[model samples]
Target: MTHIDSATAGPVSGAVRGDGLDARLVVERGSFRLDVALTAAPGDVVALLGPNGAGKTTALRALAGLTPLTGGHLRLDGDSLDRTPPESRPVGVVFQDYLLFPHLSALDNVAFGPRCQGASKADARAQAAQWLDRMGLADHAGARPRRLSGGQAQRVALARALATRPRLLLLDEPLAALDARTRLDVRAQLRRHLTEFEAVAVLVTHDPLDAMVLADRLVVIEHGRIVQEGAPSDIARHPRTDYIAQLVGLNLYKGRAEGHAVRLDAGPAITTTEDLTGPAFVAFPPGAVTLYRDRPTGSSARNLWRCEVAGLETHGDQIRADLTGELPLAADLTTVAAAELDLQPGATVWATVKAAQTHAYPA
Candidate 1:
């Protein structure tokens, strides 16, 4: 299959133009401008992950030519698609809500793309049947959009997109519309389909787990900018920003690193095994924290801070305590320990963490 390979027209400065889809999209509105550069090779599954309104959808729209770029360039398969209309682009998009036509049956919906491209009615139906059969929805080909379940509708949307034989596929929160129970099953099925796609695929999702499971690479965006891009495991182990740290469930602090100790800007200091200078970030999991009702005597822990219980909640089988004081952090403890210590909001406690438990890296 001939897919988007490479292009050099209106080359973007510092843009990656190796193979497959290469784009440097810039959209300018009053008081807000989204400028993001994206590149994906053939058979690569990339996920655009970020908080809401971080321009993920805008980037996807720009790639499909649904949204015009005020600056920068978009190229696919050695062809400059900067001025191409949305329908002409060799791209397919699966919207968050599926966006299936309510009046159309599953077979008709899947056949619509081929029919629009001048395929005969009989041929379109035949091709559509093949796609529906692949999606395991041939039994429901006569069912209308409203009659199908959430997972079935999602599969139909995917079939419709794939029926066009697009070189680039874009999925925006593909499982967001389904309930939690249905999302699990649909996610696994979607992962299987994505693995089989032999073209550039980009999926937009805010859920970290979904992004990790679906995409080979993750592009984290915030405030219309790409902050971090790497493998999911690397991003989880070393978060560059507090937003990412929070999303990955870690307590992150910025400080000036000394030999084996770092003095926090928040008034407390922490000791770590990492030896560095200048600015640094110290991160530790909530489970690393140990709380004591009274100051523990002769404790070997290098980091100790007096904090008040700001809140308490159940996290899995353990209780997570939100603390605030000299150093704000979260502590997770067993329910038995919480009951024994009489932990509650507004109660003062001493939190300790060993130097070995903290991971410090240059910021």
Candidate 2:
């Protein structure tokens, strides 16, 4: 629960630190291509966040040198590593499934890295023991990978990666193997360990909560490209694309701005207080949307859209209504209000939002 600086703390995100990771990976196959640029500073944890098939794994593989890059540069601490092989690069990777050797004991699994790096058996085992102890797995050192629990195996994988003394750490869906119950605990432990790591670390995950909790900065990728990159809070507050907006649970629209009104590309105009020009984005919380059975006569709300309820679902204590028509948006209402309005799928409703509730920013 220690507080880490929430600034835009990555190489491509904000200001670049001289001694950090600077990479651009491009891979071209027969039909699909991936081109991603990433940067992070020492002591910074960056998460590659996106939906499936968004090239998160491809970028991670390129960074770990497991996949060859068709173009672009890879640098760590001012040293170029574009041509380095996977085994030769000063990098460590923890795969989604942990990828531990089933036959190897936890101690030996961790020791294998240092041993491969030319350390003596005794030295390697000693370092491995220390790492296990740091990971709170000292007593489980003799357990085989199959005998270890999901969280324990994850710690072992992380310990093995760190045992090599890597300058850059790459984790591909590090917690994807664990169940929901274990993921929470393991995520916390991983966060603490990552905070202690002085080297640059990049983790790939499709879970927004995981990315927000484990990383200081998030680089959201879609279709083999970076769509947005910034501090987690900033990204959450002002998502640029529909994918990002959906991930953050905000209603977003793109439009052309004139004074306080934005004419959306999809034929809906939203009124806001922002004095922006040219292309812009308008976003508001689902909770800010008010659902009415009939259009209000004296309501002060400026933005009103006649929408049909396409779907309804319970979200915690609130009911989420998915609407379509003039403006496609999501609205959150209390269970009591939903019952009073007799809300259901295919029901017609009027949605309105106060101008002050809508946030407009340059797109």
Worst 10 residues of 1 by lDDT: 1-10
lDDT tens string, model 2, 60-156?
8888887788887788888889888888999999988888999899999999999999999999999999999999999999999989999999999
Q: Which candidate has the top score in TM-score?
A: 2
The global Cα lDDT (0 to 1) of model 2 is 0.88
What TM-score does model 1 achieve against the real structure? 0.91
Question: Each model's TM-score, in the order given?
Answer: 0.91, 0.93
The lDDT values for all models are 0.86, 0.88
Top-scoring candidate (lDDT): 2
Worst 10 residues of 2 by lDDT: 1-10
lDDT of 1 at 257: 94
Total backbone clashes of candidate 1, pairs 3 or more residues apart or in separate chains: 3
